[model samples]
Target: MNEILEQALLYDFYGELLTSHQKEIYEQFILEDLSLGEIAGDAGISRQGVHDLIKRCNRTLQGYEDKLHLVEKFLAIKGKLHDINRILDEYEAAGDNAGKLVADIRKISDEIIEEL
Candidate 1:
């Protein structure tokens, strides 16, 4: 993933675990894609202050990911579901012999949710 997306996911999964200042800087940097200067100006601090805040926030976010990995697991499950849905759609469009394949895919998806 791109740095922005990766950082954003870290925040989404672990924002509640972050300090208010860390969350604020992370949200502005990752979600809003604001420049360091912009964030610093908004916070009434120097550009370097914004840069330091982002670095500290990134470390904090990464620490949570290292321990939890929840975001990664969720993404994996979502991707698998999307793949199964695509297969089901294709099978429906193909018709007849693929009916069993669609049934199999649905069964697999059920199993995936059960695993979740």
Candidate 2:
């Protein structure tokens, strides 16, 4: 996955574990695409301080993902769902056995739910 997308996923999964301040800074830096200097000016910290905080947030979020593997599992499931969608499209184009395709999709969906 792309680094920015991976970071966004990690932040989505683990951000609430961060303090409000950390979350605020992280959101500005990552999600909002703020420069460190801009964030520092808004937050009344030095540029370096903003940089360090973002780095720390990255490390903390990555650490959580490393230990829990929720992000990994989520990405895998998302990929599977995408594959399922592509297969469904193919089945539709083929114009045969729609019932079987629906059943297969349901089975895959059920297994995903069970895994969760």
Candidate 3:
């Protein structure tokens, strides 16, 4: 996964667990794509403080992921859905293979259900 995308996913899954001030600073750094200096200027903190806060936020979010595995399950389900879509596309292109494609879709769906 891309680093930024992974960060975004971690934040999305566990951000509400963070304090409001942590959320605000993290949003500015990650979602708003602000530089450390920019965030520090806006928050009236030192640049080092902003950098350290962001780093700490990253660790905190990652810790939640380590414990919960929500992000991992989400990504797995997403991949399964993509596989189902691909199978559907193939089924459409190969009308004679409907039975095989349908079976594939059912198998993936079963996996998704089990994960949920």
lDDT of 1 by residue, 56-89 (tens): 8889878989998998898899788878888788
TM-score result, candidate 2: 0.83
Local lDDT at 75 for model 2: 75
Flag clash pairs in model 3: none
Query: What are the Cα lDDT values of the candidates?
Result: 0.83, 0.88, 0.89
**Per-residue lDDT of 22-91 in model 3, one digit per residue for the tens?**
9999999889999999999999999999999999999999999999999998998788787877777777
Model 1 superposed RMSD (Cα) = 4.0
Over 4 Å off in model 2, which ranges? Answer: 97-116
For candidate 3, the lDDT comes to: 0.89
lDDT winner between candidates 1 and 3: 3
TM-score winner between 1 and 2, please give it. 2
Q: Candidate 3 — number of clashing residue pairs? A: 0
Candidate 1 weakest lDDT stretch, 10 residues:
94-103
Angstrom error of the Cα, residue 61, model 1: value is 0.7
Error of 2 at 62 (Å): 0.4
